[model samples]
Every structure is written in C-alpha cells, then in structure tokens.
Target chain A: MAPLLEARSLCKAFGAVTAADNISVAVAEREVVGIIGANGAGKTTFVNMVTGYLKPDTGSISYQGRDITRLGPRATARTGICRSFQIPQTFARFTVLDNMLVALNVARKRDLFFWRPAHDAELDAVAQGLLAGLGISGHRDQIAGTLPQGVRKILDIAMAMVSAPKVILLDEPTSGISTDEKHAAMDTVMNALGERGVTILFVEHDMEIVERYAGRVIAFYDGRILADGAPAQVLSDADVRRYVVGGELHRRQPRKGVA
Target chain B: MSVLTDRNVLVLLAAIPLLIAAGPIMPDWVRFFLQVSLASGLAVLGVVVQMRAGLVSFGQGLYYCLGAYAAGMTGHFVGVTDVFALLGLGIVVAAGVAVVLGFLMSRYREIFFAMLSLALSMILYGLLVKAEVLGSTDGFNLPKATFLGLAPTEQALRFAVYALTCAVTLLAAIFLYRYLKSPMGRIGEAIAQNEIRVEYLGSSARTVVHITYVLAAALSGAGGALAALANGHVDPEMANWTTSGQFVFVALLSGTGNVAAPLIGNFLLEMIRVYAVAWSPYTWQLILGATMLLVILFLPGGLWSLVERRKAGG
Candidate 1:
C-alpha cells in the first residue's frame, strides 16, 4: 500500500536562511516515525510544511494519495491531518473537557452553536475515553492552564487525538516535561495513537526516546536529512555520529551499559 | 450551568416585556436613563467582540454612524419609519462596510488595526460634517417613529421606543453570548492566545477574525440606529473618535466575560455622568477620566472578571 503521507523534496527558506532544504520523507499507516535533530534543524518546519501551517517553495505533500501541499491548516485538518504544538497551547480559560469538545467539533465538522448542546454522544464518549487513557479524567473539569506540565502535555496530545486523524504530528512532545514523567507521557501518546491505528510523526532531541518509540528514525542536520533508517543504523552512522548523534549517543552509551 | 442555553436566553428575553410594562411607573428621567443605557450597552457589546479576540478597533464609531445615518436617511427620504425595516437597513449597511474595510483591516495587527479603524471613522466624521444634506455639524432630527403601524405621540412614543431598545439590546447580548460559546468561539479564544498555533491546528485565524469584525460592526450599527431612533437625532459626532473611545471605555470597565458586563458598565457610567454633571458639568470629563483610570489600574480584567473571582471564592 502507498504511504499514508508523502513529502517530495520539500524546501522552505526565510530571507537568506534555509529552514528546510530539499527534504523528502513518507510515513506509512500505523507507523511511528521519529525525527531527530539539533535546536534549529528545521524539524518543526518540516512538520509545519506537512500540516499546511507554512507553504514550501518547492515540493508536494500528499496525504492519503491526494496532493495537500497548498491547503491551509484548517483544510489539511479537515482532510485528517492534525498537529500538536511543542508547548501545550490550549484555551487557558476553558475547562479541559471544553478544549476536547472544541477539537471534537472540528473533527466532526459541526457548526459551533454552544446554545444547542452537542448531540454527538459518540464524540463525547471518545473524548472522555482519550482523557481517561491519558490519566487526566480526574482533571477533566480543571482549567487547562492550571494543570501540571506533565498533565498539560498529555492534554495537548489528547486534544490532538480527538480529531481521529490519519496522521498526527507532535512537535517536541516531551520538551519541558520532567525526567520522571517523560517516559510515561511518551508511552501514553504512542500507545493511544497505536490503539487508534493513527500514524505519528514526532520530533525529539532525546535519542533514547527515538530508540525506544520510533520504528524508523530520520536525523536532520543544518536543514538537511543527515541519516534515515532504523534507529540503530542511524545512530551508528559515522556522519550522524559526527553531526547529530555525537553527544546524545555518548550520554546514553554509559546508561545502557554499551560503552 | 451554561449561560448559552436557549431557556436562559428566553428567560432573559421575558424580562424585556416586564421592563416595558414597568416603564410607565418610572419617572421620565429614569426612562431616559434606561434608553441611553440600552444604546450604550449595544455599542459596548461590539467592543466586547473586538477585545475578546485580542483586537482593539477604534473604528466602531464608523459603523455606529453608518447605522445612525442609514436609519436617518431611510426615514427622511425613503419614508420607512417602521422600526424593524430601519434596523435591518442599518445592519446591512454596517455589514457591507465592514466587509470592505475588514478585508484591509484584518491584515493589520495591534496598534495599526486600532489606528486604521480610527482613521476610517474620522474620515466618515469629516464627510458627515461636510455634507449639508446630512445636517452638517448640527445633525438631522428624526420624526416620531411608527412602531409596526402604531403612532403614539411624544411621551408615550418615547416610552414605547425605549421598550423597543431594551428588547433589541437584550436579544443582541444573548445572541453574542451564544456565539462565543460555540466551536468558532473556542477557535476565537485560541486565535487570541496564539494565532500561529491556531493556524497550525488547521484553522484560519484571518477568516475567524474577519467574521468577528463584521459581526461586531453589525452590532454597532444596530446600536447606532436604535440610538438615533430613541434620541430622534443623527449627528456626525456619533461617528467621532470620542464615541469609539467611549465604547472602549465601556468594554474595559466590563471585561469580556459575561453578557451583563457591558450593560452594567453602561449603567454605571451614565449614572455617574448624570450625577457628576448635575453637581458640576465642567468637571464631568475629569471625573470620568479619573474613574476610568482607577478602574483600569485596579481591575485590568474589568468588572466581569471581578464578579467571576467573587463567585469562584464564594
């Protein structure tokens, strides 16, 4: 079967600086593809281009066999492509469940008429289930901004998951999360997506996360793909070693007893 | 409980009749106060829309004037004194203007948006002041409005008009509260927080903001038309930048939380103006300025947020 999402030679630039340079990748259905890069390796830019937040100067993005490169974010989302921001950018003044309800409305393509109570029992149930899956059912009524960082991260993923998209892009899902919560959060995200058969394309700086969760890894350096293969192969590659993986591999080697 | 409920809105809707019935029992000045409060309250609702979406539009007066002028002109030349028809024309004119101006206004941000709005309203003010047919600077006086077909004279008619204003303001307020509670409402809040993030989430911030601008303009237009009907006059000063500033003042005093905030703010301001001017008309502006400064400094989120805090604590 054709890949669920295909990016062909995508390139983006800002003034003289190139953000994404001649990059191409594909994500298969039900696959977890990890993008590993340094601070400004254009990981987020690549995701933005795919999700239609930013248009590429060159390249076509096809989702489910249709070209969606030029579609705006809402159009792309309507086509079952959604993204979660690096930080949990939620409706701070609203309740957690209300946030999910908004996502559910978008996913179901319902006109937003709050006076007319939502009649989609299935959507409500699904949102509750996702919240429960993320272990945030206890705080369903809490204001999203007041939640702990770990819970907020989970809520962000949960909101994205509400759309039931074919592919979901997570930008640095565990960036500010505490070390103790990172693994659990990642596990919940991956497991929930896996259970729903949703494809995931996530960017991460942590090589251990890439190794543990990613079925495939793409390493980016200086706005270009440095390596693309299994995590072990990409991590062991000499060029990746010199560029993206040098410090990360060295730090993890001792902990994994592989020095 | 959700304030967006139809039943809740209907219950509020029922209060309009009660207020209308009680209007005859109140003194003439009290009835006049209610009419002014309703007019200002509607304009403040327009302010709430802009402020809630992180926009500050100083051109609301442009639409307000558009409504007033549309109603005045239609009544003068078209001979349509039917209140509903005049209101419809006012809203249509305002929405049309908003569509044209919003295309340009939606592209600008922050202070530029506010400045552009002010410029647009000032341009309208200049035109109205220059046009002798539009009553030049003195403004046009509207004849008695015939409600549906009933023509009552002077005091009885003014009371009837005040009742109509109350009904329209309450309906508009309830509709706005419902609009903000919908899916678009959530998207609006997201846009206010982070436009880029909203776009990344597969939503168009521009489209959302533009729609909001047009809706706000339409509301302001309705308010302006009603004010003209209630006061029986239309003037260039209605479109002045000072009028826009007044709406902003009301919005800031109310915050954007509840539908009742603007009504409360308008009432308080009008009441203060009445009493302050009674004591010394020359010091009224100074008193208003000082009171606004205190409100901004002490309650930045406006009075609605204060009410919310109180409710949460209690």
Candidate 2:
C-alpha cells in the first residue's frame, strides 16, 4: 500500500546552514514514529517541509499519493496533514473550548459567513469530549494563556487532533512539560491518537520516550537520516550512537535497562 | 441558544422604539447630534471589525469619504435624492474600492498594514482636495433627502432622518451581533490571537483578513452615506486623517467583544465632546485626551468590559 505521507530527496538550506539535505521519509497509516536529533540537526526542518510550513529547495512531498510539495500550511492541513508547534500556539485570550470550536469549525468546513453562531450544543459536546479524553476538561473554561504549560501542550495537540488528520507532525510534544509530567502527557496524547488510529511522527530529545512509545525510530544527524528502523535496532546503530545519541544513551540506558 | 445567539435581539428591538420616541421630546440640537452619533458609530463599528482580526486600519476614512461622496454625487449628478438609493449606491461604491484595495492591504500586518491604510486614505484626501468638479475642500451641500417619494418639510425631515437613522443603526447592531457570534467572526478573533495556529486548523489567515477588510469598508461606506444625508453636506474633511483617528478612538473606547459597544461608545463620545466644547472649548481636546487615558488605564477592555463584568457577576 502507498504510504500515508512520503517525502522524496528533500533538500533545504539557509545561507550557510543546511537545514534539511537529501533527506527522505515515509509515514505509513496508523504508525507511531519518533524522530530523534540534536538541535539544528534538521529534524524540525524535515517536519516543516512535510507540513508545508517551509518549502524544500528540492524534492517532492506527497500525501495520500497526491503531490503536496507546493501547498501552503493551510492547504496541507486540509489534505489531512496537521502539526502542533514546539511552543503551544493557541488562542491565548479565548477559553480552551473556543479554541477547540474554531478547530472543529475549520475541520467540518462549516459556513462561516452570515448569522451562525460559533458555538452550539453539538460543538460544545464534541469539544468537551475531546478535552475530557485528553484529561484536560477541567481547564476547558479557563483562558488558554493561563493554563499550565503541560495542559497548554495537551490542548494544542487536542486542537490539532480535532480535525482527525491522517498524519500529524508534533514538534516536541513534551518540550515545555515538566519532567515528571512528560510521560503522563505523552500517555494521554498517544492513547488518544491510538484510539483514533491516526499516524503520528513526533520529534523528541528524550530517548526514553522514543523507546517506550515509538514503534519506529528515525535518527537524524547533520541534515540526514542516520538510521531508520525499529527502536531497538536504530538506537543501537553505530553511526546513530556516535553522531546523535552518544551522551544521552548512558543517562537514559539505565532507565530502560538497555545494554 | 440557537446556532447564532439571539439573546440581544430583544435589547435591539427595545432600543428602536425608545429612540424613535425620543425624537419628539428631545431638543432639536440634541436630536441632530444623536443622528450624527449614530452615523459615526457605524464607521467606528467598521474599525472594530478590523480590530477583531488584529488589524488597525488608519485609513478607514477612505471608505467613509467614498460613501459620502458616492451619496453626494448621486444627489448632485444623478439627481436622485431618495435616501435609501443614495445609501445603497454609497455602499456599493465603497465595497468596490475595498475589493481592489483589500487585495493589496491583506498582504500586510501590524505597522505596515496601519501605515498602508493611512497612506491610502491620505491619497483620497489629497485627491478630493484637488478635484474642483467635486467641490474641492469647500464641498457642496446635499439636497434634502426624500423618503421613498415624500419630501418632508425641514422640521419633518429632521424627524424622518432621525427615525431612519435609528432603524438602520438598530438593524446594523443586530446584524453585527449575529456576525460577531458567527464562526467566521470567531475565526477572526482567533487570527488576532494566533495566526499560525489558524493556518494549521485548515483556514487561511490572509483570506480571513481580506474578507474582514472588505466587510469593514462596506459598513464605513454605509455610515458615511447616512452622515452625509443627515448633515446635508459632503466635504473632503469627511476623509481626513483626523476623522479616521476619531473612528479609531471610538473603537478603542468600545471593546470589540460586543457589537453594540462601538455604537454606545460613539454616542457617549459625541455627548462628551459636546459638553467639553461647551464647558471648556479651548481645552476640549485636553479633556478628551484625559478621558481616553483614564479609560485605557481603568477599562482595558473598553466600556464593554463593564457590561461583561456585570453579566459575569450577576
């Protein structure tokens, strides 16, 4: 079967820096993949290019077997490819439920012109259900800006999920979350997506998370994919260990009981 | 509780009859000033619409002048004095201008957007000042507006225009209330908050901004046409920078959260300006400035916040 999303020979550079260079990736439907890389290693660039936030210098991106390389972020999102930001991007002054409602409106392609209200019983019920599923219903009425970072992160993900995209690129889903709360945040997010049978490619620096949640791993180094395979195989690859995961392995190895 | 909130319909319905009745008991000057306030309020409401999308259009007077000029020209050139026809033509003309300019204006944001709008309005002001055929700076008077086919006497005309203004203003408020509650309107607020997130939600921020710019221009144009009809004059001053600034001031004075805020704020501002000029004509500007400062400091959400707070509390 064709992959849910595919990138072919993607290359992008910023002046002297190559943000993504000759990197290719495919995300299959219902697959949970983790991407690991150091800062400036092109992990984000790859995701950006795929989600149409940034255009690649060369190569093509296809979603559901259709070319989407030139599409803008909005167009790409409409094609069932959505993304959450590294920093939570939400309507800060609005309540959490309002944010979800806006997402649902765009997702459903509702009529925006004329006298229809933004809220209804059906929309409220759906928003509340999504919030409850993510364990953040308590914060639904609160202003999104005032929520704790972990809750904000979860809310951002939940807003993206409201569209039920075929593939979602989450940029550091647990970055701002407290270390203790990181795993719980991921558990809520992964379980929610899993229940929907949605494919996800999430970037993370936390090796433990990659090991625990990711069935497939893609290690990036110097704008190239160093290794791509099952978590155990890719984590032990010599080049990945030397270039990307070297120092962090010793600290995280004991937690995962990996040799 | 309908798809569009209808709670404010009763308030709107009540305001119309009360305003219509006030025309007889109110002094002539008071009634006249109220008509002007309602007309100007429509323009301020336009500014508020753009503000919801995080845009501050410093050139909204362009449309205001366009509306007035359009109405004025219809009476002077086309010799059509029917108030509704004049207003309709004005709206169509302003919307046409917006369609062309919105394409360019929508690409900008922040200071660039504000300045570009200002530049466009100033351009119109300069052109109006130079156009000898259009009465230039001195401007020409408008013929007494007719209602359908009846041309009332001067006293009756004032009451006619006043009643019409009240009806139009009430209808605009109701229409705007529905729009503010609409999904499109909420998305505009979302654009103001986080445009990037709006894109990821599968809606183009630029498209939303463009639509808002055109909608606002239409409203401003209609307001300008009404003002022209009420004042019985059309002048280049209608499109001046100071006029645009006043519209902005009114938008700030009234929070964008509620559709009626700008209308109420504009009326209050007119009353305050009248009293200030009467009480201390030389320092009226100082009084206006002071009031603005106090409102900003104490009511960051403008006068509407008071209403919101009361509703929340009660």
Candidate 3:
C-alpha cells in the first residue's frame, strides 16, 4: 500500500538559516512516528512545510498519491491532513463543544444556509463523541481557555480529530503539562488515533514518553534527520547520542535495566 | 415562528406599531425622536458587525455617506423620488464601493487596516465636499420620498416613514442575528482568534473578512439612505471620520452579544444629547465624551455583557 504521507528531500530556509534541509520521510498507514529534536532543530518547521503552512524551497510532498507541495494549508487539511499546535490554538472565549463544532464545520461539505434542527443535533452528537473519546466530555461546556493545560491539549487534539484526518501532526502534544498528566494525555491521544486507524507524526522532547508510544523514531538536528529506526536503535545510535540524546539517555540506560 | 418567539427581537418588532400610534397621540418632537432612533439603530448594527469580528472600522461613514449621497443624487439628477428605487440605488452604490475597497482593506491587518480605511473614507469625504454637482460643502437637499405614487403631506405620513424605517431596521437586525449564528459567522470568529489556523483548516481568512466588510458596508449604506430620507438632506459630514467614530462608540457601548444593545445605545445617546443640549447647547460633546469614557472604563465588554452578567446573577 502507498504511504499515507510522503516527503522527498524537503528543504526550507529562513534567510541564512536552513530550517528543513534534505529531509525525506514516509508515514505508513496506522503508524505512530515520533520526531525528537532539540530547540531550533527544525522539527516544527518541517511539520509546517508538510502541512502547507510554509512552502518548501525544494522537494515535494504527496499525500496518498496526490502532489500537494504547492497547496495552501486549508487545501492540505481538506485532503485529510490536520495538525495541532505546540500551544493549543483554540477559540478562547468559545466553549469546548463549540470549538469542536467549528472544526466539524470545516470538515463538512454541506451548504451552511440550511438551518435544520436535525443537522445541528447530528453535529452535536459527533462533537460530543470526539470529546468523550479524548476524556474531555466533562468539560464540554467549559470555556476552552479556562481549562487546565492538559485538558486544553486534549481539546486541541479532539478538534483535529473532528475531520477524521488520515495523518495527524502533533507539535509537542505534551508540552507544558504536568508529569503525571502528560502520560494520561499521550495515552488518550494515541488511543483515539489508534481506534480511528489514523497515522500520527508527532514532535516530542520527552524521551520516555517518546519511547513508550513511538513505533518508529527519527532524530533531527540542525534541520536534518540524524537517525531513524526502532525506538531502541534510533535512541541508542551514536550520532543521536551525541547530538539529541546527549547525557540524558546515558542516565536512563540503568533505568531501562530496572524496567 | 422562530422569529416571533425570540424575546429580544420581539420588543423591537412591537416598538414599530407603538411608535406609529404615538405619532397621532403625542407631540411632533416624539415622532422626530422615533425617526432619529430608528436611523441610529441601523447605523449601530453596522458597527456591531465589525466589532464582533474584532475590527475597529473608521470607514463605515464612507458607505453611510455614499448611500445618502446616492439617494440624493438619484433624486436630484435622475428625478427618481420613489423610496424603494432610491434605497436600491444607495445599496448598489455602497456595495460597489465596498467591494473595491474591501479588496485592498482585507489584505491589511489590525491597525494598518483601520488607518487605511480611515484614509480612504477621508479622501471620499474631501471629493464630495469639493464636487460642484453634488452641491459641494453646501450639501444636497433630497426630495420628499413618495410611497408608490401616494404623497401624504400630513404628520401621519412622517410617522408612516418612521415606522417603515423601524420595520426595515428590525428585519436587518434579525437577519444579522441569524447570520452571525451560522457557520460563516463562526469562521469570522475563528479568523479573529487565529487567522493562520483558520487558513490551515481549509478556509481563507481574507475571504471571510472581505465578505464581512462588504456586508457591513452595505448595511451602513442602508442606514444612511434612511437617514437622508427622514431628514430630506445629505451632507459631506455624513461620511466624516467623527461620524464613523460615533458609530464605533455606540457599538462598543452596546457590545456584540445582543442585537438590541446597539439600538438601545443609539436611543440612549440621542436622548442624552437631546436633553444635554436643552440644558446647555454647547456642552453636549462634553457630556457625550464623558459618558463614553465611563462606559469604556466600567463596562469594557459593552452594555450587553452587563445585562448578561446581571441576568446570570439573578
């Protein structure tokens, strides 16, 4: 089967600084791929180029056999690719349910002028279902901005899932959440996507969380992939050790034996 | 049936008949008050559209003046005094100008958009002030509008026109309330919140904003035409920056949550100005400025939010 998303030699730059340089990766259907990188390692920039938020200065992106390299962000989303931000970008004043509903509307191809009560009821059911799947049903009526960071992150993931995307990109999905809450949030996100058979490519800084969830891991440094393989092999690679793993993986090596 | 059931809108619908009835029983000043309130309500609704989308437009007066001038010119040069035709001409002219300006204005964001719109409107104001055919600074006197060839010279006719204005304004308000609850309106809110995110979601922020700008301009033009019809005159000051500021002030005072807020603000402002001038003619500006400052300081979300908070508390 064709890869769900394929990027060939993707290259992007910001003036003198290259943000994504000669990167080629493919995410298979139902696969969970993690990108681990340090600060300013071009992870977010790579995701931006793939999602059409930024144009790659070189190379091409194809989703399920369609060349979508030059397509706008909205077109990419319509073609079954969606993304969540590092900091959840939600309608702050809107309720969690309303935010989900808006996303559903974006996914819809129906005429908006029709004001049938039945249509609204169907949308409500779908939004509630997604929120429940993300374990955020209890906060459905709560204003999104007022929610805790972990819950807000879940809501952001839930919004992205409204379209039932083929490939979902999460930019530091566990960022700014408490340690105890981070695992729970990741479990919810992974489980929801797994149930939908959705492929995910997420950027994460937490090594354990990345190891626990990622079936395949790719290490990025200075706008290029430094390593790619199973979590154990990639995390243990010498280049990844020096550039990305640093001394942290060495500290965790004894803990791996404990587990 | 849904329209009739809405309590907030029901009051405005009911006010039209009540105002018309009072014209026969009450003084001429009361009838004039009703007419001014109706016109001001329409203008305020125009402002609500911009404010709700998190835009501060200083160019609404451009459309308002265009509508008024269009009506006046059509009556003077084209000899069309039919109310419906005059209003239609005003809408077409205003919509045309909005489409052209929106193309440029929608490309700009935040303070840049506001300043560009202000500059464009000011240029139009200057052009109108200098045009000899448009009566220059002396302004144009509009012919009395006849309703389907029936010209009534009685006080009842003025009341009838005012009642018509109220009906049109209420219909527009109701339509706007429903429109804002639609998907397109939600997209506008999304654009205001995170424009880039909205774009990534398969929607163009520029398209959404441009549509909104044009719609608001068309409505403001409708309001301006009604004002000119009621007063039987159009002036360059109708589209002045200060006039645009007054619309924004009323909108900010009203808030975006309720359609009635702007109408209420307009009525209150007009009544307060009337009373203030009666007491001391030159002090109306001071009173208006002070009242606006207080509203901005105490009720930042506008009067509608205050009403919502009070109801929630109760």
Best by TM-score: 2
lDDT of 1 at B304: 81
Q: After superposition, how far is residue A82 of candidate 1 from its true place, in Å?
A: 1.6
Q: Write the per-residue lDDT of candidate 2 for residues A1-259, one digit (tens) a residue.
A: 8898899999999998998889988888999999999998999999889888899999999988999999989999999989988999999999999999999988988626647778989999999999999999999899999999999999999999999888988999999889999999999999999999999999999998899999999999999889999999999999988888888897654665546
- Evaluation by lDDT, superior candidate among 2 and 3: 2
lDDT of 2 by residue, B186-297 (tens): 9988998989989889997888888889889988998999999999999999889999999998898888888888988988888898999999989999998899899999
| Estimated TM-score for each candidate | 0.93, 0.96, 0.95
Error of 2 at A178 (Å): 2.3
Q: Which 10 successive residues of model 1 chain B have the least lDDT summed?
A: B1-10
List, residue by residue over B214-236, the lDDT tens digit for candidate 3: 88888888888888888889999
> Mind giving the per-residue lDDT tens digits that candidate 3 earns over A149-178?
889888888888888899999999999999
Q: Candidates' lDDT values, in order?
A: 0.84, 0.90, 0.83
**TM-score of candidate 3 on Cα atoms, chains taken together:** 0.95
- The DockQ-based CAPRI class assigned to model 1 is acceptable
- CA RMSD of all predictions: 2.6, 2.2, 2.4
**Candidate 3: what lDDT?**
0.83
Please give the lDDT score at residue A98 for candidate 3.
82
Give per-residue CA lDDT, model 1, range B1-314, as digits (tens). 35544675776778789888989998888788878788767878987887788889887899999998999899987888988888888889998999998899888778999999999999999999999998899999876788888887777778777888888888888888777766776677767776775665566678778888998999999999998888889999988999999888888887878877898788888888888899888888888788888889999988788888898999
